[model samples]
Target: MIGILAAAALQADAPVEWTALQQDNIQVAELAYDVGIALAVICRDDQLMVAITGLPDPAPGAKFRKLEVNIPGAELQASTWRIQGKATISLAPAVYARRLRTADHLTVRAPAEEGEPARRYELALPSDHLALDQTLEACDVPLVLETDLTYDPTISAVTWATSPRITPPNRLPPGGYAEVVLECTVGARGRPENCRAIREQPANSGFARSALLSIRTGRLGLIDGGPPPVGGVFRTRLTINVVN
Candidate 1:
Protein backbone atom coordinates (compact mmCIF):
# COMPACT_ATOMS: atom_id res chain seq x y z
CA MET A 1 0.00 0.00 0.00
CA ILE A 2 1.12 3.58 -0.57
CA GLY A 3 1.33 6.19 2.23
CA ILE A 4 1.61 9.95 2.61
CA LEU A 5 4.85 11.37 4.03
CA ALA A 6 5.34 14.70 5.71
CA ALA A 7 5.68 17.77 3.49
CA ALA A 8 8.63 20.13 3.86
CA ALA A 9 9.62 23.21 1.87
CA LEU A 10 12.99 23.34 0.14
CA GLN A 11 14.92 26.54 0.63
CA ALA A 12 16.22 28.45 -2.38
CA ASP A 13 19.52 29.65 -0.91
CA ALA A 14 20.23 26.47 1.02
CA PRO A 15 23.87 25.78 1.77
CA VAL A 16 25.31 23.30 -0.65
CA GLU A 17 26.09 19.96 0.97
CA TRP A 18 27.64 17.19 -1.06
CA THR A 19 26.46 13.66 -0.33
CA ALA A 20 27.82 10.44 -1.75
CA LEU A 21 25.68 7.41 -2.49
CA GLN A 22 26.47 4.16 -4.22
CA GLN A 23 24.32 2.66 -6.95
CA ASP A 24 25.58 -0.66 -8.19
CA ASN A 25 29.26 -0.03 -8.95
CA ILE A 26 28.89 3.71 -9.59
CA GLN A 27 29.72 6.37 -7.04
CA VAL A 28 27.50 9.45 -7.20
CA ALA A 29 28.29 12.75 -5.50
CA GLU A 30 25.14 14.88 -5.50
CA LEU A 31 23.94 18.26 -4.30
CA ALA A 32 20.30 19.33 -4.43
CA TYR A 33 19.39 22.99 -4.18
CA ASP A 34 17.52 25.94 -5.70
CA VAL A 35 14.05 24.49 -6.11
CA GLY A 36 14.31 20.98 -7.48
CA ILE A 37 17.69 21.40 -9.12
CA ALA A 38 20.08 18.51 -8.55
CA LEU A 39 23.71 18.51 -9.58
CA ALA A 40 25.63 15.31 -9.56
CA VAL A 41 29.02 14.03 -10.58
CA ILE A 42 29.21 10.33 -11.24
CA CYS A 43 32.20 8.04 -11.36
CA ARG A 44 31.81 4.55 -12.80
CA ASP A 45 33.56 2.09 -15.04
CA ASP A 46 36.55 4.40 -15.43
CA GLN A 47 34.37 7.25 -16.70
CA LEU A 48 33.17 10.51 -15.19
CA MET A 49 29.84 12.27 -15.85
CA VAL A 50 27.96 15.36 -14.75
CA ALA A 51 24.17 15.72 -14.59
CA ILE A 52 21.71 18.47 -13.81
CA THR A 53 17.99 18.12 -13.15
CA GLY A 54 15.00 20.52 -13.45
CA LEU A 55 15.53 21.29 -17.11
CA PRO A 56 12.74 21.44 -19.67
CA ASP A 57 12.52 19.22 -22.72
CA PRO A 58 14.55 20.42 -25.68
CA ALA A 59 12.91 21.59 -28.88
CA PRO A 60 13.11 19.57 -32.06
CA GLY A 61 15.75 20.53 -34.65
CA ALA A 62 17.65 22.55 -32.12
CA LYS A 63 21.19 23.06 -33.32
CA PHE A 64 22.96 24.01 -30.08
CA ARG A 65 22.15 21.29 -27.57
CA LYS A 66 24.84 21.21 -24.94
CA LEU A 67 25.61 22.39 -21.42
CA GLU A 68 27.64 25.53 -20.83
CA VAL A 69 29.68 26.49 -17.79
CA ASN A 70 30.94 29.98 -17.03
CA ILE A 71 34.43 30.13 -15.64
CA PRO A 72 36.73 33.04 -15.20
CA GLY A 73 37.51 34.46 -18.66
CA ALA A 74 36.04 31.46 -20.48
CA GLU A 75 32.87 29.54 -21.37
CA LEU A 76 33.07 25.81 -21.97
CA GLN A 77 30.55 23.61 -23.81
CA ALA A 78 30.22 19.86 -23.87
CA SER A 79 27.98 17.24 -25.47
CA THR A 80 24.78 16.86 -23.49
CA TRP A 81 22.61 13.85 -22.67
CA ARG A 82 19.09 15.00 -23.42
CA ILE A 83 16.31 13.31 -21.50
CA GLN A 84 12.66 14.17 -20.98
CA GLY A 85 13.24 16.79 -18.30
CA LYS A 86 16.93 16.69 -17.42
CA ALA A 87 20.31 16.76 -19.12
CA THR A 88 23.72 15.21 -18.52
CA ILE A 89 27.18 15.79 -19.91
CA SER A 90 30.06 13.39 -19.93
CA LEU A 91 33.46 14.60 -18.83
CA ALA A 92 36.90 13.08 -18.52
CA PRO A 93 38.04 12.78 -14.93
CA ALA A 94 41.06 14.96 -15.60
CA VAL A 95 38.93 17.58 -17.35
CA TYR A 96 36.35 17.56 -14.59
CA ALA A 97 39.02 17.97 -11.98
CA ARG A 98 40.24 21.11 -13.67
CA ARG A 99 36.89 22.66 -14.68
CA LEU A 100 35.02 22.00 -11.45
CA ARG A 101 37.85 23.55 -9.54
CA THR A 102 37.49 26.88 -11.30
CA ALA A 103 33.96 27.07 -12.66
CA ASP A 104 31.68 29.58 -10.98
CA HIS A 105 28.35 28.59 -12.47
CA LEU A 106 26.81 26.00 -14.77
CA THR A 107 24.25 27.11 -17.34
CA VAL A 108 21.99 25.55 -19.92
CA ARG A 109 20.28 27.39 -22.77
CA ALA A 110 17.65 25.44 -24.66
CA PRO A 111 14.75 26.31 -26.89
CA ALA A 112 11.36 25.80 -25.30
CA GLU A 113 9.19 22.98 -26.64
CA GLU A 114 6.53 25.48 -27.73
CA GLY A 115 9.05 27.49 -29.83
CA GLU A 116 9.56 30.17 -27.26
CA PRO A 117 12.93 31.90 -27.01
CA ALA A 118 15.68 29.87 -25.43
CA ARG A 119 15.78 30.01 -21.66
CA ARG A 120 18.93 30.14 -19.61
CA TYR A 121 19.22 28.12 -16.41
CA GLU A 122 22.12 28.73 -14.10
CA LEU A 123 23.32 27.50 -10.67
CA ALA A 124 25.92 29.30 -8.61
CA LEU A 125 28.79 27.74 -6.75
CA PRO A 126 28.37 27.14 -3.03
CA SER A 127 30.30 29.46 -0.74
CA ASP A 128 31.88 26.69 1.31
CA HIS A 129 34.67 26.01 -1.11
CA LEU A 130 36.73 24.12 1.44
CA ALA A 131 33.97 21.57 1.99
CA LEU A 132 33.43 21.25 -1.74
CA ASP A 133 37.17 20.83 -2.15
CA GLN A 134 37.07 18.04 0.41
CA THR A 135 34.21 16.37 -1.40
CA LEU A 136 36.09 16.58 -4.66
CA GLU A 137 39.13 14.98 -3.06
CA ALA A 138 36.99 12.16 -1.71
CA CYS A 139 35.77 11.58 -5.26
CA ASP A 140 39.42 11.41 -6.34
CA VAL A 141 39.17 14.76 -8.08
CA PRO A 142 41.53 17.65 -7.42
CA LEU A 143 40.22 20.81 -5.74
CA VAL A 144 41.38 24.15 -7.14
CA LEU A 145 38.27 26.25 -6.62
CA GLU A 146 37.74 28.60 -3.68
CA THR A 147 34.90 30.84 -2.46
CA ASP A 148 34.18 32.94 0.63
CA LEU A 149 30.41 33.37 0.95
CA THR A 150 28.16 30.88 2.76
CA TYR A 151 24.49 30.36 1.87
CA ASP A 152 21.59 28.32 3.16
CA PRO A 153 18.06 27.77 1.94
CA THR A 154 15.41 30.16 3.16
CA ILE A 155 12.75 27.69 4.30
CA SER A 156 9.22 29.04 4.66
CA ALA A 157 7.21 26.56 6.69
CA VAL A 158 6.51 22.87 7.02
CA THR A 159 2.91 21.72 7.28
CA TRP A 160 1.33 18.41 8.24
CA ALA A 161 -2.03 16.73 7.65
CA THR A 162 -4.14 14.45 9.78
CA SER A 163 -3.17 10.80 9.77
CA PRO A 164 -5.10 8.61 7.36
CA ARG A 165 -7.31 5.76 8.46
CA ILE A 166 -5.72 2.33 8.22
CA THR A 167 -7.60 -0.94 7.88
CA PRO A 168 -5.82 -3.83 9.49
CA PRO A 169 -5.54 -7.14 7.69
CA ASN A 170 -7.69 -9.90 9.16
CA ARG A 171 -4.86 -12.39 9.49
CA LEU A 172 -2.42 -10.21 11.36
CA PRO A 173 -1.19 -11.24 14.82
CA PRO A 174 -3.06 -9.72 17.77
CA GLY A 175 -0.41 -7.05 18.44
CA GLY A 176 1.51 -7.10 15.16
CA TYR A 177 1.77 -3.92 13.11
CA ALA A 178 3.08 -3.00 9.64
CA GLU A 179 4.93 0.11 8.52
CA VAL A 180 5.26 1.68 5.07
CA VAL A 181 7.41 4.50 3.77
CA LEU A 182 6.36 6.77 0.90
CA GLU A 183 8.14 9.33 -1.23
CA CYS A 184 6.09 12.09 -2.81
CA THR A 185 6.71 15.04 -5.08
CA VAL A 186 4.70 18.03 -3.99
CA GLY A 187 3.54 20.22 -6.89
CA ALA A 188 3.74 23.99 -7.05
CA ARG A 189 0.07 24.09 -6.13
CA GLY A 190 0.71 22.32 -2.82
CA ARG A 191 -0.77 18.99 -3.95
CA PRO A 192 0.96 15.67 -3.39
CA GLU A 193 1.45 13.78 -6.64
CA ASN A 194 3.53 10.90 -7.92
CA CYS A 195 3.58 9.21 -4.52
CA ARG A 196 5.03 5.71 -4.29
CA ALA A 197 5.97 3.29 -1.55
CA ILE A 198 9.72 2.97 -1.15
CA ARG A 199 9.81 0.49 1.72
CA GLU A 200 7.41 -1.69 3.58
CA GLN A 201 7.67 -4.01 6.55
CA PRO A 202 6.14 -7.50 6.16
CA ALA A 203 6.22 -8.51 2.54
CA ASN A 204 2.87 -8.58 0.75
CA SER A 205 1.21 -6.79 3.60
CA GLY A 206 -2.07 -5.00 2.82
CA PHE A 207 -1.09 -1.87 4.76
CA ALA A 208 0.68 -0.35 1.77
CA ARG A 209 -2.46 -0.38 -0.31
CA SER A 210 -4.48 1.28 2.40
CA ALA A 211 -1.87 3.97 2.92
CA LEU A 212 -1.85 4.93 -0.75
CA LEU A 213 -5.62 5.18 -0.92
CA SER A 214 -5.74 7.49 2.07
CA ILE A 215 -3.07 9.80 0.62
CA ARG A 216 -4.84 10.00 -2.73
CA THR A 217 -7.97 11.22 -0.95
CA GLY A 218 -6.18 13.39 1.59
CA ARG A 219 -5.36 17.06 1.11
CA LEU A 220 -2.04 18.65 2.10
CA GLY A 221 -2.21 22.34 2.87
CA LEU A 222 0.54 25.01 2.93
CA ILE A 223 0.70 28.21 4.92
CA ASP A 224 -0.66 31.38 3.33
CA GLY A 225 1.92 33.71 1.74
CA GLY A 226 4.60 31.19 2.45
CA PRO A 227 7.45 30.76 0.07
CA PRO A 228 5.78 29.60 -3.13
CA PRO A 229 5.97 25.87 -3.54
CA VAL A 230 9.10 24.89 -5.45
CA GLY A 231 7.95 21.47 -6.55
CA GLY A 232 10.09 19.93 -3.81
CA VAL A 233 10.06 16.37 -2.52
CA PHE A 234 8.95 15.04 0.88
CA ARG A 235 8.53 11.70 2.67
CA THR A 236 5.92 10.20 4.97
CA ARG A 237 5.74 7.07 7.10
CA LEU A 238 2.57 5.14 7.89
CA THR A 239 1.99 2.38 10.39
CA ILE A 240 -1.00 0.14 10.91
CA ASN A 241 -1.17 -1.40 14.36
CA VAL A 242 -4.87 -2.13 14.82
CA VAL A 243 -6.87 -4.99 13.30
CA ASN A 244 -10.21 -4.63 11.66
Candidate 2:
Protein backbone atom coordinates (compact mmCIF):
# COMPACT_ATOMS: atom_id res chain seq x y z
CA MET A 1 0.00 0.00 0.00
CA ILE A 2 1.20 3.57 -0.71
CA GLY A 3 0.41 4.54 2.87
CA ILE A 4 2.59 1.75 4.24
CA LEU A 5 5.38 2.68 1.89
CA ALA A 6 5.26 6.33 2.92
CA ALA A 7 5.28 5.45 6.61
CA ALA A 8 8.25 3.13 6.18
CA ALA A 9 10.19 5.88 4.44
CA LEU A 10 10.00 7.97 7.60
CA GLN A 11 11.38 5.35 9.96
CA ALA A 12 13.01 6.84 13.07
CA ASP A 13 16.07 4.66 12.73
CA ALA A 14 18.91 5.09 10.28
CA PRO A 15 22.18 3.32 9.81
CA VAL A 16 24.29 6.32 8.88
CA GLU A 17 23.18 8.64 11.69
CA TRP A 18 23.32 7.88 15.42
CA THR A 19 20.81 8.66 18.18
CA ALA A 20 21.75 10.44 21.41
CA LEU A 21 20.47 11.54 24.82
CA GLN A 22 21.54 13.58 27.83
CA GLN A 23 20.68 12.91 31.48
CA ASP A 24 22.19 14.15 34.74
CA ASN A 25 25.17 15.63 32.85
CA ILE A 26 25.88 12.26 31.23
CA GLN A 27 26.04 11.90 27.48
CA VAL A 28 25.07 8.73 25.65
CA ALA A 29 24.91 7.80 22.00
CA GLU A 30 24.48 4.61 20.03
CA LEU A 31 24.46 3.38 16.44
CA ALA A 32 23.52 0.04 14.94
CA TYR A 33 25.09 -1.82 12.04
CA ASP A 34 23.17 -3.92 9.59
CA VAL A 35 24.91 -7.04 10.82
CA GLY A 36 23.07 -7.41 14.11
CA ILE A 37 25.53 -5.38 16.13
CA ALA A 38 25.30 -2.12 18.05
CA LEU A 39 27.93 0.17 19.54
CA ALA A 40 27.35 2.63 22.34
CA VAL A 41 29.49 5.38 23.82
CA ILE A 42 28.56 6.26 27.39
CA CYS A 43 30.11 9.34 29.02
CA ARG A 44 29.36 9.67 32.69
CA ASP A 45 30.78 11.12 35.90
CA ASP A 46 34.36 11.52 34.57
CA GLN A 47 34.51 8.11 32.88
CA LEU A 48 34.04 6.94 29.30
CA MET A 49 32.77 3.53 28.23
CA VAL A 50 32.39 1.91 24.82
CA ALA A 51 30.12 -1.07 24.63
CA ILE A 52 29.87 -3.40 21.64
CA THR A 53 26.86 -5.67 21.91
CA GLY A 54 24.97 -8.33 19.91
CA LEU A 55 28.09 -10.21 18.94
CA PRO A 56 27.92 -13.76 17.70
CA ASP A 57 28.47 -16.30 20.41
CA PRO A 58 31.74 -18.15 20.70
CA ALA A 59 31.75 -21.86 20.04
CA PRO A 60 30.91 -24.08 22.95
CA GLY A 61 33.89 -24.95 25.19
CA ALA A 62 35.86 -21.86 24.06
CA LYS A 63 36.87 -19.17 26.54
CA PHE A 64 38.26 -15.65 26.41
CA ARG A 65 38.58 -12.59 28.58
CA LYS A 66 39.68 -10.23 25.84
CA LEU A 67 39.08 -9.61 22.17
CA GLU A 68 41.62 -8.83 19.46
CA VAL A 69 40.52 -5.77 17.54
CA ASN A 70 41.66 -4.52 14.16
CA ILE A 71 40.67 -1.22 12.55
CA PRO A 72 42.26 0.95 9.92
CA GLY A 73 45.83 1.84 11.05
CA ALA A 74 45.65 0.02 14.35
CA GLU A 75 45.48 -3.40 16.04
CA LEU A 76 44.69 -3.60 19.73
CA GLN A 77 43.05 -5.59 22.52
CA ALA A 78 39.63 -5.08 24.12
CA SER A 79 38.33 -6.23 27.48
CA THR A 80 34.90 -7.79 27.88
CA TRP A 81 32.99 -9.42 30.67
CA ARG A 82 30.72 -11.46 28.47
CA ILE A 83 32.51 -13.86 26.12
CA GLN A 84 29.53 -15.69 24.74
CA GLY A 85 26.39 -14.54 22.91
CA LYS A 86 25.80 -10.77 22.84
CA ALA A 87 29.23 -10.02 24.24
CA THR A 88 30.13 -6.45 25.16
CA ILE A 89 33.72 -5.22 24.95
CA SER A 90 35.49 -2.21 26.41
CA LEU A 91 38.51 -0.55 24.82
CA ALA A 92 40.37 2.64 25.53
CA PRO A 93 37.78 5.35 24.78
CA ALA A 94 40.31 7.76 23.35
CA VAL A 95 41.86 5.21 21.05
CA TYR A 96 38.55 3.75 19.94
CA ALA A 97 37.09 7.20 19.38
CA ARG A 98 39.94 8.15 17.12
CA ARG A 99 39.29 5.16 14.93
CA LEU A 100 35.48 5.24 15.05
CA ARG A 101 35.41 8.83 13.85
CA THR A 102 37.09 7.97 10.59
CA ALA A 103 37.35 4.27 9.97
CA ASP A 104 35.05 2.43 7.62
CA HIS A 105 35.09 -0.91 9.34
CA LEU A 106 36.35 -2.79 12.43
CA THR A 107 37.39 -6.43 12.58
CA VAL A 108 37.24 -8.41 15.79
CA ARG A 109 38.74 -11.81 16.50
CA ALA A 110 37.45 -13.91 19.31
CA PRO A 111 40.03 -15.64 21.43
CA ALA A 112 40.17 -19.41 21.01
CA GLU A 113 41.84 -21.82 23.39
CA GLU A 114 43.12 -25.39 23.20
CA GLY A 115 44.01 -25.39 19.53
CA GLU A 116 40.74 -23.85 18.41
CA PRO A 117 40.90 -21.18 15.73
CA ALA A 118 39.86 -17.65 16.55
CA ARG A 119 36.47 -16.60 15.22
CA ARG A 120 36.44 -13.36 13.26
CA TYR A 121 33.76 -10.74 12.63
CA GLU A 122 33.66 -7.36 10.95
CA LEU A 123 31.58 -4.32 11.95
CA ALA A 124 30.69 -1.41 9.70
CA LEU A 125 31.32 2.02 11.25
CA PRO A 126 28.70 4.60 10.38
CA SER A 127 29.75 7.97 8.93
CA ASP A 128 27.14 10.50 10.08
CA HIS A 129 28.53 10.97 13.58
CA LEU A 130 27.31 14.29 15.01
CA ALA A 131 25.53 12.76 17.99
CA LEU A 132 28.80 11.47 19.35
CA ASP A 133 30.65 14.73 18.80
CA GLN A 134 28.35 16.72 21.04
CA THR A 135 28.36 14.10 23.78
CA LEU A 136 32.13 14.24 24.06
CA GLU A 137 32.10 18.04 23.88
CA ALA A 138 29.79 18.20 26.89
CA CYS A 139 31.57 18.38 30.26
CA ASP A 140 30.82 18.05 33.99
CA VAL A 141 33.82 19.29 35.97
CA PRO A 142 33.96 20.15 39.67
CA LEU A 143 35.62 23.47 40.43
CA VAL A 144 38.16 23.67 43.25
CA LEU A 145 39.87 26.52 45.07
CA GLU A 146 43.21 28.02 44.00
CA THR A 147 45.90 28.38 46.65
CA ASP A 148 49.59 28.29 47.56
CA LEU A 149 50.91 26.38 50.58
CA THR A 150 54.16 24.59 51.27
CA TYR A 151 52.33 21.30 51.74
CA ASP A 152 48.55 21.65 52.13
CA PRO A 153 47.10 24.86 50.73
CA THR A 154 43.58 23.42 50.61
CA ILE A 155 43.49 22.60 54.31
CA SER A 156 39.71 22.82 54.08
CA ALA A 157 38.93 23.31 50.41
CA VAL A 158 35.42 22.94 48.97
CA THR A 159 33.46 22.27 45.75
CA TRP A 160 29.98 22.65 44.26
CA ALA A 161 27.23 22.47 46.84
CA THR A 162 25.41 20.71 44.02
CA SER A 163 26.79 19.36 40.76
CA PRO A 164 25.96 21.20 37.54
CA ARG A 165 23.61 19.67 35.01
CA ILE A 166 24.68 20.30 31.39
CA THR A 167 23.21 19.58 28.00
CA PRO A 168 24.27 19.66 24.36
CA PRO A 169 24.34 23.11 22.76
CA ASN A 170 21.52 24.20 20.47
CA ARG A 171 23.86 25.08 17.61
CA LEU A 172 25.27 21.59 17.01
CA PRO A 173 24.63 20.19 13.55
CA PRO A 174 22.08 17.47 13.03
CA GLY A 175 24.66 14.71 12.76
CA GLY A 176 27.87 16.56 13.61
CA TYR A 177 29.42 16.36 17.08
CA ALA A 178 31.97 18.67 18.73
CA GLU A 179 34.67 18.88 21.41
CA VAL A 180 35.16 21.71 23.91
CA VAL A 181 37.47 22.43 26.79
CA LEU A 182 36.89 25.00 29.53
CA GLU A 183 38.97 26.58 32.24
CA CYS A 184 36.84 28.15 35.00
CA THR A 185 37.86 30.37 37.89
CA VAL A 186 36.22 29.67 41.24
CA GLY A 187 34.47 32.56 43.00
CA ALA A 188 33.15 32.73 46.55
CA ARG A 189 31.82 29.39 47.88
CA GLY A 190 33.46 27.62 44.91
CA ARG A 191 30.93 28.91 42.40
CA PRO A 192 32.40 28.75 38.88
CA GLU A 193 32.87 32.19 37.28
CA ASN A 194 34.73 33.72 34.36
CA CYS A 195 34.72 30.37 32.63
CA ARG A 196 36.82 30.52 29.51
CA ALA A 197 35.90 28.01 26.87
CA ILE A 198 39.53 27.31 26.06
CA ARG A 199 38.65 25.02 23.14
CA GLU A 200 35.83 24.29 20.75
CA GLN A 201 36.31 21.97 17.82
CA PRO A 202 33.94 23.68 15.38
CA ALA A 203 34.43 27.25 16.62
CA ASN A 204 31.35 29.01 18.10
CA SER A 205 29.23 25.85 18.12
CA GLY A 206 27.53 26.88 21.41
CA PHE A 207 28.89 23.82 23.23
CA ALA A 208 31.03 26.10 25.37
CA ARG A 209 28.13 28.32 26.33
CA SER A 210 25.99 25.43 27.52
CA ALA A 211 28.75 24.04 29.74
CA LEU A 212 29.56 27.44 31.23
CA LEU A 213 25.97 28.35 32.06
CA SER A 214 25.35 25.08 33.86
CA ILE A 215 28.53 25.49 35.93
CA ARG A 216 27.59 29.02 37.00
CA THR A 217 24.44 27.67 38.61
CA GLY A 218 26.34 25.24 40.85
CA ARG A 219 29.21 25.31 43.40
CA LEU A 220 32.50 23.40 43.86
CA GLY A 221 35.18 23.04 46.50
CA LEU A 222 36.73 19.95 48.13
CA ILE A 223 36.63 16.21 48.04
CA ASP A 224 33.94 14.65 50.22
CA GLY A 225 36.51 13.56 52.85
CA GLY A 226 37.92 17.07 53.30
CA PRO A 227 41.42 15.76 52.69
CA PRO A 228 43.85 17.58 50.44
CA PRO A 229 44.40 15.90 47.12
CA VAL A 230 47.58 13.83 46.95
CA GLY A 231 48.62 16.00 44.04
CA GLY A 232 47.29 19.54 43.90
CA VAL A 233 44.40 20.00 41.47
CA PHE A 234 44.46 22.88 39.01
CA ARG A 235 43.81 21.51 35.56
CA THR A 236 42.82 18.29 33.88
CA ARG A 237 42.53 17.13 30.27
CA LEU A 238 39.44 15.08 29.41
CA THR A 239 39.09 13.81 25.85
CA ILE A 240 36.23 11.73 24.43
CA ASN A 241 34.55 9.91 21.45
CA VAL A 242 31.01 9.40 19.96
CA VAL A 243 28.23 7.58 17.92
CA ASN A 244 26.78 10.33 15.74
* Positional deviation of residue 221's Cα in model 2 after best superposition, in angstroms: 36
Residue lDDT tens for model 1, 106-198? 555544456666567666655444434544555666454332111001111234453345656556644588877776777645655787877
Estimated TM-score for each candidate: 0.40, 0.42
Instruction: For candidate 2, write residues 1-244 as lDDT tens digits.
Output: 1222223224444464567867786686676655555666667776766666655454564333456675324554443333323445453454455456667777777677446667667767778777776655553321111211111111122344676765667756445566556565556665656666666656677766776676667656443224323433332112223355
The candidate scoring highest on TM-score is 2
After the best TM-score superposition of candidate 1, give how far the Cα of residue 188 lies from its true spot, in angstroms. 51
Poorest lDDT segment (10 consecutive residues) of candidate 2: 145-154
Which residues of candidate 1, in runs, are more than 4 Å off? 1-14, 60-64, 71-85, 91-97, 111-114, 127-244
